[model samples]
Structures are given as structure tokens and as C-alpha cells.
Target: MSASQALGGPSRCGWVLGPSLDKIIKNVAWRKHSQLVAACKSALDKLDSVVDDPVDPASCTPLYGLSTSDTDFVLQPLIMALDSASPKVVEPALDCSFRLFSLGLIRCEIDTPTPTPSPSPSPNPSSHSHIFRLIDSVCKCGALGDEAIELAVLRVLLSAIRSPYVLVRGDCLVHIVRSCYNVYLGGMNGTNQICAKSVLAQMMIIVFTRVEENSMMVDFKTVSVAELLEFTDRNLNEGSSIQIAQNFLNEIVDVKSKEGIAESKLCLQLEYDNSEKKGEPIDGEPGEGADLSGYSKIREDGFMLFKNLCKLSMKFSSQEHGDDNILLRGKVLSLELLKVIMDNAGPIWRSNERSSVVKSVDTSVNLDNKEDAASDDLCISKPRRSTRIVIPPKRLDSYLWAGRKSREQGKS
Candidate 1:
């Protein structure tokens, strides 16, 4: 008989060692720094062996047979270790967690059978919970340290987001938004903020692509555009959200151009130039062609986000006191964001009647303010050049104030 059979089957084997593993994991929290690091390294080494096993299927891996509760028990301590002050403990903890996450994904695959002509298969509940807990842990790790840890956290996140299991991907999406919002509002600086924004940008691309292809596993209702906008709005004071929004809009613009703006505008346009063309309406069920409804919804939501940011910018500008350099910086960032948004979403802007009318009004105003050569020569431009030179010092002051604010916020 095989070793598994001799041990009274995989389930029995799991039951036998579960308690021992449980005890070891529990003691991890109480161990001294050195002992804790050693334990994490030991656990990681063992897990690495199983994870790297080429001969055994996932079901035959060491972690596959543990019950859900036992699995969680084993995972909880390692996850907590990710927050350890020592990099030695956190690194091994991160590795161990990632290996466990991989095994969980494998277990999920084995539990869920291939689809036939029947109804769609649901994800395994135990595996779903396991994966979600791990995802949350990894998300928390994003704020732990500098470049190395952030890169590691990002690697874990990318794996989860790109997971073949739809449920895992969906859970990943939710946690990413939560993590981004937390990191942004928590006023994390330097690498932490960069990591959060990078992850957010990556998630936006994946979500947008999924929606475009009608392959998104979760409903937009679950992770609504409104919630995403709030996440962006909350970080406006720091200007990171503006950068995030700018990157997303840039991607949307590129995608629209590559996919052909005419196709996307089909649903947006009130009247089509080709009246002779007859087919299903753009809103109707797509036969052989791709659906345009998704594109339309994306455009609507993108514009909504853009509009809200603009309003927030105005609100911040109006509320700014001379001493509040933070608000002043926010306004500058918002202006930069507006410039980028207009450039990137030009197609959408041009399609809007109000924008076109505003553009015309601005052109007329500029023309009305035009100066003659004699008058322009009489007005020295030195003051304008001097004002431009003064901006850098003001920007430096705002940045210093922002850093102080972040530190105070953290202290609070």
C-alpha cells in the first residue's frame, strides 16, 4: 500500500499531525525574537518542500488534508508574525503565508469539479475563507516596510489577483480596495504610498479589462465605482489619489483609442451618421459582435469620478487659508490632474455638449483679453517670471507641511 493508505488515508494523516502543528504555531507568539525567527524559518523550510514537490499532486501536498479550522489555526500565527519588527521574522512569515496560500488555491481547485451542462459550480467554502484570510494578511503587509517588503507584498497580491479561481480573484479585488483606502487614509509615506497606488493602478486595469470582456466574476455593485471614488477623494489632500486617477484615465484613453473610439461612442451618441446601417441597437444583446454597454458604463463612471474630483478640487481651493499649505498643494495637484484628465479623456469631453460650449466660451474670453503689440511691449514680463521663480519655494514649504501633517496623523 502507499504511505497515505498505511497512515489510514489522507484525512486521518491530517488529523494525526494537526494538533502538533497547532501547538507549534500557537507557541510562535510567545517565543523570544530569536526563537520566533527560527520557528518561522523552520515552518517556511517545511512548507517550501511540500510546495516545491514535483511528484505529488496538490491533494497529496502536506497542507491539503487539514480541516478548515485547523488550517486557520495554523495560518493565524504566521500572519501575525508578518507585523513583527524584525525583518527576519516577517520575511519568513511572508514566505510561509504565500506557500500556504498557494496550497489553498490548489485545494480549492481539487474540491471544485469541472463544469458540465449543469449549473455553475460554487467555490469551496473552506478554501475561500482560507484564501481570503491570506489575502488580507498580504494586504496588511503592504504598509510594513520599504522597497523589499513592498515588492514581496505586491508579488503576493499579483498572484491572488491573477488567480484562476474567480472567487479568489473577487476576494482579492475587495481587499485591494480596502487596503488602498486604509494606506491612503492612514497617511503612510514614501514606499508604502507608492506600493498602494501601484497596486490600485494595477487592479484598475484588471477590473477594466474584465468588465470590457464581460468576464468579471464580481458585480460592480459589490465593489461600486462610488466606493472607489471615495478612496480617491480621501487621498486628495496628499495628492496620491490624483496620481492614481490620472493613471487610470490614461489607461482608459489608450484602451479606447486602440479599440476604436467610434465603437465605444455608439451607445453614447444621440444620432448615428450611418442611418442606412441596420442592426441590433448598441444596448441590445450582442450577437457575434462585442457588447458596447460595458464601454458606455465605463465612460459614464469614469466621467462621474472625474467630475467629483473636480468639485472636490474647487471645494479645497475655496476653503484654503493662507497658512494651510496642505490645501494649496491639493489644489495644485488637482489642477495637474485636471490637465491630465482632459488630455486623456478628450474623446469623452468632446462628446459632451457642455464641455464643447465651455471650450467655446473660454476661446471667446481669451480672444476678448488679447493685448495689442504696443500694450504688450509696455507691460514688462519680469514680474510674471519672478512669480514663476517664487513657486518652487512655496511648493517645498507645502511638501514639508504635508510631511508634518502625516506624522501628526500617524501619532494620533
Candidate 2:
């Protein structure tokens, strides 16, 4: 019988293998499912200690263990029910699989034939597709799970970022970017290393560029104006001469309050309003929705940061302000900081004005698909959630040297 049929759903595990492994869910009670997990884990264990090197591909293979037939059976049921599975069992199991694949305990035999039409169709179009599925699913699960599961995933994540394969590394980086982005966008607070305080500070600096520029073309008309700004402005220009003026503006409008709100909430509110409006049904142009449709507002507010500094400069320029060189220098620095924000954030002073560089980032699928430069080892450079860990180079050399020394000493 086919693996899917033999191992389809709860029946196979419940009636066939439950007596031995003893993981029948009772309430959800997937018997054959547990057996499948065990079988998958056993196969994965067999691949442990396999070597991975481009010059010696066999070094990374017990290729016979993870054939196409095996992963198909394993992935199907688990994914279909992942969202519904009890967190206690499923999260840990998925974590184990993720770590197994990352550690090379689970050997995979991929048939990456040349791009040609063949008489028999392949079950999977590409060898790397399953690896993608595993990473995607586990991250999705991690996104939904509690602290423990997410932390477990982070550990496995730190491992996958070290993978040798281009596709795997790229996929892991995308996950890392997404995961970090979600934490920030999700309104998470405190010093979580996975997201990190310093990184958030850095990202806020990165975000000061307008959504169009930072998103590099992803189009934030899909996002809100407030969110776009909050995600970007991370307390830039902290200790310059504009303190009184920035404070006055802050007092006038609580700019920081919006930053505290999560994008998910904003997105939901807009969704609710859309739903209510739809129920009545009378609108034109969809009201431009929540995103900022024009540059005037951002320019107006951002230039407010410059206004006080500009006043100070005007005083300096007119020689009204004495050679209290520190004051003059502070004014110059404040204006410089404001200009940086404006250039990066992308708001036009006049409709006819042109920026030398377009503020749009190339947030294209194509960009993520390409391999990331070695930002660190194992970076595929995709913009998902990712992490980094230090591994000693010549790792396998240490293993080989120790093994060889042991054999020689024994012979002596």
C-alpha cells in the first residue's frame, strides 16, 4: 500500500502502531501519526555524523535514508494539522525535526535533474522545496506558540543559519528577518535577545527612511503612515540643540503614543472599519484606506524637527548669535540630523522636487531568492527572521583528527 494510504490520518497510528509508541491523543487521538514521527526520527538519527562539503558531497550523505518517499509521508499529515495540534507534543516534535535537519542527522536524497521534460513526473519539482517547507512550517508554528516553543525554534534557527546550502541559508535568513520584524511590529516590549534591544534601536535607525525607501519598493500603501514612521524613527537626534523645539512639538502632539501601538492592531482596526463600511455600501476610491497617500503630512511634521534648528542657524547666519561656538555648532549638528532624516524618510519639499535616489527599496521576491552575501556564515540574505552563532572553522577537521588519533593510538 502507498505510504499516504497506509499512514493516512489517525487510523494507521491508532489501530496499527499505538500499542507500541503509546502516543494516541485520546481526544484527537492520532495513533498512526505518532508512529510516523518515530519512524521519521529514526531515519533522521541514522544520518547523524554524515559530512557536508561541496568538494565531497558524499561526505554529507547516507542518501538512501531520506528518500523522496519518506519526507512526503512525514510532512503531509503534520503540516495539515500543525495549527490544530496540541502545543505540548507538536511544537517539540517540530523543533526536533528542525534541529535534526540543521544538524544533518536527517539525510536527504534529492533528485535535482537538469531542466528537461521526462516521461515520468517527479514527486517534487526541486530537491530544496521540502527544506523550504520544513523551515516555513516550523516558523509559522513558532509564530503561534508560547515562549518555550519559540525559544526552542530560536535555538534551531541559530543552527540553520549555519547551513552550507544556498537555498537553506537564504530561507533561514528570511525567517530571521521576518521573526524580528514581527516581534517589533507585534508590539513586543523588553529586552528579548531574539529581537534584541540594540537591534530594535538599529532597525529604528534603518526605518527612518520612508516606508517606500526602506521597504525599498514593497509599497506601504499596504501599511499605515503612523506605523511606517514609528517602525523607523528610533529616537534619532537625542542630544542636540533642538531639545526645546522637539519637546514643544512632542507636547503638542504625542508622537510617541502611536509607536507603542502594534501594526496588527492598526491593521485590524482598518479591517473593521472596512467591514462596517461594506455593510452599508457607499464609497468612492476606498478613502485611500489607512496609508498616507501624500507626502505633505510627513514633510510637515518632520520639518518641524528642523524648524527650531533652522531658527538657530538663522541667528548664527545673521551674526545675531555670538561666537558661543558650542551653541553655533549644536545648531549646525541639529540641522544636519534633520536633513538626514528627511533624505532617508523621503518627503518632497515641493511637488516638483526630485530626490536623486528613489526612496523605494527593492522588496521583491527576486531579491530574497538570490543568495545573501556572507553577512555572516550561512546568510542567504532573505528578509525573514534569522540569527547568528559562532562555529569553529575546520569543524570536521577536529572530528577527523580526533578519530584518526584514536585509531593510531589503539594500533600502537
Candidate 3:
């Protein structure tokens, strides 16, 4: 029998899936955990035949044709299932949801056309809206702490990044970046906050390292450092923007360190004499003399991103005043970020340049101290000077003299 016929015809396919979903919702509402698990399994099995393992693409027609209400009805229970404590229920629900998502059958929202006097009112929402919804759902689901669920969420995100639809891919990238910024800024809480932090780190590693691989099929055009910074600045407050700028700088330093290690290994491999293994395929060995050329673009983009971040942090450090916790944290993170960047990208910004940046940062910190002292005249008899100064090695004289020169210039 054809797939639709096997599910009692396309018209009745919803019927086959609906009862199980309804039971899931009912059991969940009643707190009947065992029954809810069973219902979820049954729903997943039906979904597999109809959506996941259809005889052909046409077999999913019934699902695609579901009315907006019916579609919402089907999705509601699955979303609820994602919140269940039981892994059995959460796993099946996630699978069913991902299947529906991949097949473009999930309509995240229904758009009702407003009656317009004009001939052309705008286009309906893009079909890819479902991808965003799916991501949001998976990331916010309570079961995200589960290792399996976390992996599934990461897989969904990476797959979306590789989507053939340019709109879908670009939107997904922007959504992930925005979500990361939101989490960092404390705009999100609970499971969503945790999921965003974990996913962003993993996604950064993948995008910076393996995204250009032809085997991965990820469109490299969607990953732009400038666009990332733009989105981050748009989404974050001034203080949070500085914090995220430092965060990106740290990530770049990390990737550059890894690349440096890989290059060192490649050099050692090339120097080793392997004449005894004449017939061996030298390139086949994993990480042995592998091509590093693909990463050159990433490295250049990373350096450009680093330069922009430095400028941003410096701007904020010079402009922002007071001892606000967020601002203080941003300053600390920026200092650490500069240290890491100097360690990793020292060739690009020389040792003397590093000392200059440090000196500039130290001056900003002291300015903050003077402002703090001025505010508390009743609590203190005299304006205190910071005894401890941060000085980079072999550059004590420059840092000390630069700070004194700046102070004398301000006094004069």
C-alpha cells in the first residue's frame, strides 16, 4: 500500500497523528508521566511513517496540507513533550519536531492578510520562519541539559547553517548571534540562557575551524565578521557591547592558538624524513602535513575583527565613567582579551604596540579611580593614588613614563 493509504489516506493522516498528540497533551496536563511517554512514542512512530520515512516526497503531502489550526494543534503537544522530564518523551518529541521542521511542514505563525486598498500588500512570511521557531523551541526546551538533546540542538543549528536556502541560512546565523548576545547581557534566563551559552561556543568553534570544508557544504558567504559585529552592536547595550567585543577577541585568540599549534605540527611533519615509507600516501594521515591555506581567509577576517574590537573597547574605556559593574567587567575582560591577543597575534601588533595599548588602558583605569575619589570626599581625607600598576615585561620604563606624562599633561 502507498504511504498515505497505509496511514488511512491523506485526509485521515491527521486523524492518525492527532489522537496520539492529544493524549500526550492530556497526560502531560494531568501529570501522568508514564502515559505521556507512551503517547509521545506512538506519536513519533506515526510521524516516522508519515514524515520521516515516507515512501517518497509525495507521501508527506498530507502533513504539508494541514490547516493552520491543525498544524498548531499538532505542534503544541510536541512542544509540551519537549518540556517533559522524561528523556524518552523528550527525545521522541525532539525527533518528531526536527522531522517536521526539515520537511518545511511547521508554520511558526499564521499571517492573516490585512485588507488593503492598494493592489500589492507585501508578501507572506517566508517558509523558513519555521526554522527559526524550531531553533527557538529546541534551545528553550527544558530538556536541553540532557547530553543527547544538546547534541540534537547543535545538529539542528549546524544543519540550518548549511541550508541551501540563503534566507534561511543567513537568518539562522543572525538569530544565533543575537541569542548569544542576549544571553551574555542577562536578557535570557533558565534553560534558554544555558543553551545559548553552550551552543554559541560550539558554533563559534565550528564556524571558525571547519566551515570552509567542502565536505561540510556550509556556505561561507553567510559568515561575515563585519555582519557579526553589526548585529552584536545592534542587539547589545553600550556596556554589553564592550563585553561581547572582548568575548569575540578571546574567541579569535583561541582559534589562532589552535592554528598555530597545527602549523607547528605540520612543519615538524614536513621536516621528518619518510623515505622508508615510499609507497605510503603522505597526505592521508590525519593532521599530518594537512593544507592550512583554507584557514588564511579566516585568519585575515579574525585579525580584522580583532582590530575593530580593540577600537571599540578603547572607545568605551575612554568615554564611559563611574564604577558600574557592567563597565568594570567590560574593562577587566578587555584587559584580559588584549593580553591573549598579544600572546597569539603578537607578530601583527609588536611588543612596543602592546605596551602602548596597555598604557592607554591603564590610564583609563586611573581616570575611573580619580572620578570615584571625587565622589567620596566625606569618606576620605585625601584623593588616593593606585599604588599597583600593570606593566608588561621588559617595558617598565615606558609604562611608568607614559602614565606620568599623561598625568602631567592633564595637570598642566
Candidate 4:
């Protein structure tokens, strides 16, 4: 009558109601019996009905139509197979979970509760535990050179990052960062390389915007930027390190403080409004300027973060041309940090400009210097495989003709 009996029993509901199946697997000494493994493999194939068509073309999940008991029956076996030692069982298990997660059948949980002693345990497994197990399976597959599995897992992780739950987003971010770090350390293979690039690009966009705007809401304290830099430094040689540091610095310069402040206000307002909609406090008094205080604090912290990053980069960038006494050398002791402050502290910088506190120089004099700096910046910023201008070689006759014309004109 239970889910497990349905799986091993001769009934249509066996595959549909199978959480009780875990009890049978637990009861049997399957670890010691070769026949039990074969039976599990066969049972898994049948229970994995949603592996191929979890969601229809319109992104509708047919699983929602199923009764709650039926959903539990289907998900339980897949969750169990995720931990199966056999790759055959694990593959379909992963496929089923990925499909269900992608189809929105299982919502990502914010908190994963630890199992404790209880009089009665529920047959249903926690979605949180399922997700963690799925991620574990993904890492194992990647280690075993299962490129396809890695890509599937990445898609699921990306979906989880968009969850409204902050904890879910943080967990997803950790998974992505770990994936990227692994790719960096192990050297990304073909399919996994593509998967990593796709994931990293999405992650960078999310992190950059989220950190720039709702710095308070999105928790990134768990992910250490310094640790990321160190990991990247280990994988990168001196030349590459200099280039990455230079490129990041150039990107920083291109970020405009005025636009950033405006964007921050918009994002903060949205966050406050959303919180209120969800019946949560706005963190401060609800008014036009409620978020202003938070925004200012975030701005200050952002400036400090950038200042620290630039200082850290200086240590790395020095390796490129230590003897040349680079740009940081002999400069106003605190000028670099000052520039960062000015760039981010729009009010102070704008006030100084208005009061003529900062001197202006002729544009033409700095034109050559600007061009050189632009070129250097481009070396780091632009894609290496960019379109280039190709000039044709001038023929000797063209030069001679021009010389003869000049002589004739002068004589005339």
C-alpha cells in the first residue's frame, strides 16, 4: 500500500506512488546483493517517466496536474537514485531532477533543515537535500568527464539563482563560483568550457548589477573577492595577471558615478516597494528618502571596496614593470585612492569642479597622452581577436608620379 511496495509490486501505481519504495530499499541488503542493484536499475527506468518530457513545449509542467501523493511517489525514487553508485541509475536520476527543477515542479528552498530525532518521519524528502545531492552528482559527473551532466546542472543552478529567496540565491552563487574556480583549476574541457563560460557570463552580470544596486539585499560576504583574486592569480601567470588587473581597472574607470547613483536609487526603491508588498519592513521609515541613507552607506562601502581592490591590484600590477617605476610610483602618496573617491563620491567631485578647485588643462596637450593611455587600456579591455585595418602597399609609380607633379607645379 506504500510507495515502495507500489514500485516493486505489480500495480500501475507502483511507479506513481513510490516513496515507500525507499523503505524497501533500506530494508533490503541491496549493498551486498548484485540482484538488488539490477532490480533497482529496472525500477528506476520505469519510475523516471518525466526524464524526457517533464515540461511541455509551452513550459507547462504536467506534474502539477498530478496529486500531491503522486508527485511524491515520482520524486522519491529519483532522489534516491541520485545517490546510487551505478552511473546508469544516477544518470536518469539526474535527468529527472534537472527536468523537474527546470519545469518548476520543485521550488528552491531557502533553508535546509538538519535531520533530528523525531517520532515519525515523512516519506517525502526535502527539496533542499535533493538539490544538494543533485549538485553533488553533478560534480561527480564532471569529475568522471560527463560534460552533458555538467551543462544540465548549470542550467538548474542558473534557475535557482533567480529564486526570490535570498538564501537560495546565495547558495546558487557559491555553486557557480565553485564551478568557475574548478574550471580554472582543472582547465575547462570543450563542453564544460562552454558551459562554464555561459554560467560565468550570467553570474558576472548578476553580481555586477546586484552589488552595484541592492548591495544590502544581496549577500556576498560569503564569497570572498580576495579569495577569488588569489585563485585567479594562481592560475594566471604574471603577464595575464597584469592584463586582468589592468582590464578590471579600466572597467572601473568607465563606470560613471552619476549614473550609478541614479541606478542605485531606482533599485533600492524597487527593493523597498517589494518588501512592503511582501509585508516586510522597509528597513527604515517609509518615505521618499527612506532608501537614501542605505544608498549612501552602500556607496561609501563600494568606494572602500574599490579602493582596496586597486591597492591589491597595485601589488600584482607591479610585477609587470617593477624597474620602470610605473604610474603608481612617485605619485601623490594617496592620489590613486583620491581618484577612486572622486569618481564614486559624485557630490564632492562635482562641488570641487563647480568651485574651480581642480585645475583644467588644455585638451590638445593631453591628446597624445590620452591616446597612449587609451591604447594601453585597450590592450587589456578589448577582445584580442578584433577586426583590424589592413592597408595595401603603395606602388612605386604612385610616389614617382606625385613627386613629378610636385616638381612640375613648383616649376610652373
Best by TM-score: 1
lDDT of 2 by residue, 26-102 (tens): 32334645654555444333223222233632222221123444445444434433444456555544554444444
**For candidate 4, lDDT tens digit of each residue in 1-412?**
3554434243233333243344434544566544544555455445544332324211112233333343444544554554454455455555544444443344333223345843542223444454555555554454444545555455545444432221233333444445543542343343344334334434443343343554433422222222223311232343344344334323322322211233233433443333312121121122332232333323323323333323322333433444442223212112222222222222332233221111111010121223232222101111112111111112212322333345346448
lDDT of 2: 0.33
TM-score computed on alpha carbons, candidate 3? 0.34
Residue lDDT tens for model 3, 1-412: 3554433224333434544454454445455666555545555444444433234322212234444333433454565666565565556556555444333333222122233543542222222233345466665643344555554554444443322211122233445444443443343333333333334443444443322231222323222323333312233334444344344333322321111223222322232221122122111112334332333322323333333334434433423354454453343333333333332222222233221332333333332333233331111001121122222222322333344465456548
Off by over 4 Å in 3: 1-70, 83-88, 100-131, 142-145, 169-173, 178-412
RMSD of each: 16.4, 24.4, 17.9, 17.6
Better of 2 and 3 by TM-score: 3
lDDT leaderboard ranking: 1, 3, 4, 2
**Candidate 4 runs further than 4 Å off:** 1-73, 110-127, 162-167, 206-412
> What's the residue-level lDDT of 385 in candidate 2?
23
Rank ordering of all candidates by TM-score, starting from the highest: 1, 4, 3, 2
Quote the lDDT for 111 in model 3. Answer: 22
**Regions of candidate 2 where Cα sits further than 4 Å from its true position:** 1-65, 74-85, 106-127, 169-176, 187-412
The collision pairs in model 1 are none
